[model samples]
Target: MKDLTYRLPQRRELTTALPGPKSRELSARREAAVTAAVSPGLPGWVVDADGGVLLDADGNSFIDFASGIAVTSVGASNAKVAEAVAEAASHFTHTSFMVSPYESYVAVAEKLNEITPGDHAKKSVLLNSGAEAVENAVKIARSYTGKNAVLVFDNSYHGRTNLTMAMTAKNKPYKTGFGPLASEVYRAPMSYPLRDGLSGAEAAARSIRAIEQQVGAENLACLVIEPIQGEGGFIEPAAGFLPALSQWCTENNVVFVADEIQAGLCRTGSWFACDQEGVVPDLVTTAKGIAGGMPLSAVTGRSEIMDAPVVGGLGGTYGGNPVACAAAIAAISEMEEHDLAARALEIEAIIREVFEPLNGQDTVAEIRGRGAMVALELVDAEGHPNAALTAKVAAECKAQGILLLTCGMDGNVIRLLPPLVISEELLRDGLNVLVKSINANS
Candidate 1:
């Protein structure tokens, strides 16, 4: 297969208005063909992306801060990942692992096993998405413990699947009008230091007490949590909260599951965010950045817990596709060779330099996050969530040829998930645009 010849420039340049004429044309076609339930984050239609640059249909170049929602840590079109994907596709594309296995599948699993939080003997089962990995993790936990209850926290976003919808905290968009959701899923308070004014230990105590009173530990199959809560405003629980919960789970024999779908794969300057806290979970669900934007996910954990489920209990036809596996292998290599984890730390410093000063401002409530996965929480004069302001800033940034993403329970957060390989110059330019927009909107 021949490859595209154009070299993507690592800068932001807009030749036309926000949508451009071609993008508006494509938008019309999408309106007729695509469902209204699905929405595009930006108006521009992406034609190509490399490093931190996105080329849209109208020839407008954008600086990427969304990184496809943290999936492209190695960059949108890393040479190694593209080459591996093309080579693998040339050989063969699909042969369901359940029916006919391939070496790439095992290789991906092996890599996951090695990179996940623990040093203990571990095994992995690949799947199609983060929600699938989470569901399968619950199944494995239940199979091993023979329990019924699953515990999650406030402001958590597991996925949109039936089970995850029940696990998720938000109701309006994700769970509303979809009643009779999966049962036995319970919610507890999460550590929001800014909101609660509590220390890590205090937050953990609050959460543990809620779990005990609401759902007994003995009855819980697993307690799933995000080390650095992603959709929940990038709230990194206070230092001791995770360790405290982990210990409680160990004492109670409840499987501690870390949902690292967004914070893993070196996005947080560590292989897994759990590593930063020295809290090792029994089962970890990873996706998003794992395969460099490929549709792949995995549940990697202790061998005993992973093996509890029957041979055919966990897998999908498209799970661990060969081409995706090849991409993962190459993506992991790029992460290691370039020490992107360290680069994430550098990115965090740059972002913090820009956002930290605005923390106590009228419109900026807080600034929090780790490594390359950072965010700014917007609030009104009375400290209430200012979703309108957040929307305005993101829209203004997009209009200026910089892509940004927003997330939060109240939709008042601007998250930064820049590609790990983004050049310092491009990243600074994007940040400048974001700051200008925020100031302009505020």
Candidate 2:
């Protein structure tokens, strides 16, 4: 494995207070220029980022508990990725894959085809974002199966596109006011081991029963799922649940599409989170961490299913842009040479190590996640979701120079998505802040 040579300082340092004068001025300007709909989770504006730290306009360097919403697995600006991007940009930025082909695009496709789950001859369609990849996956699935229904899970988070928004389980913020969503999108139960008392088999049976009764297996084109639901608070579908669902999809000819957008590309202890369970998805959509924050996504699957779409059925103007493809090539190379999957496991171990002491705390209902994508679900004394405490804890951590993010429909989950490249020292320091924050908030 290649040794890390992090350029940024390893420790959190604050030259100014939380949102300092410069960041506050920028925020004020941003309010006037940017859309109100675009929520800035952090009050400060970022000027630079490297390794596991984000340097804001305020000169406050924060330990990045959230890796740009899990997009920068190899670190926000890996030297290798930046160098590749610069070289690619110098040659040609974009001719559009449809207008003119490039080797970098083809190389990225080849890498994705080789790495993604499943051994069957796989074909990939590249896009600019997770939403686009998902949209294309649906198109491919429907084309292959000649079916209209697409099944997504409750508490699942897909994307913001029209079809993907309908696929998403949350109604507010993401789905609200987005009227007349795409049709034939069905919501099914997910396996949340903490919330539901059912075993993996039982959860699978429950979901299957719902799918069979509501959206019949014959009518379904595909079952799009996150092996680990990201916005649903990093919920890992119970063991055996995914395999059973995959088996069911196989038996019924349903295209089981695993949305590994936030969980893939070595962010979750494995190349893909589906690898943990050996769940070979017929169609797997990937993005986010795929290009080390270069805005590249792909839908790779069995060749037969992927080929169902006619010529020109799936091509995007900016999809697989040479620059992004170059970044992807570099990012994948870094992941391989650095053994990022193992790094993700090590990150998870560090997080769990810090969390073990707080295991019995009532406010800390559950501490879960695989690899660097971990979360703490906070609940009140009555065992109800405690959004208040969650907010407080995050605020306290941020004040102390740790950047943590909250998720879940109820907004009670504090998710930690430190870059897989985070050092043991920075990770432990972030965890220390997290622990202190949670204790004070509790």
RMSD to the true structure for each prediction, in A, is 2.9, 1.2
- Candidate 2 lDDT score relative to the true structure: 0.91
Error of 2 at 403 (Å): 0.8
Instruction: List the lowest-lDDT window of 10 residues for candidate 2.
Output: 1-10
At residue 26, candidate 1 shows an lDDT of 95
TM-score of each: 0.97, 0.98
lDDT of every model, 2 decimals: 0.91, 0.91
Model 1 residue 99 CA deviation (Å) reads 0.9
lDDT of 1 by residue, 1-442 (tens): 1112235777789999778999999999999999998889877999999988999999999999999989998888888899999999999999999999999999998998898887999999999999999999999999999999999999999999999999999897999998899999999999999899999999999999999999999899999999998887899899899999999999999999999999999999999999997999999999999888889999999999999998788889999999999999999998998888888998988888876557667888888899999999998888899999999899888888888899999999999999898888888899988887777777
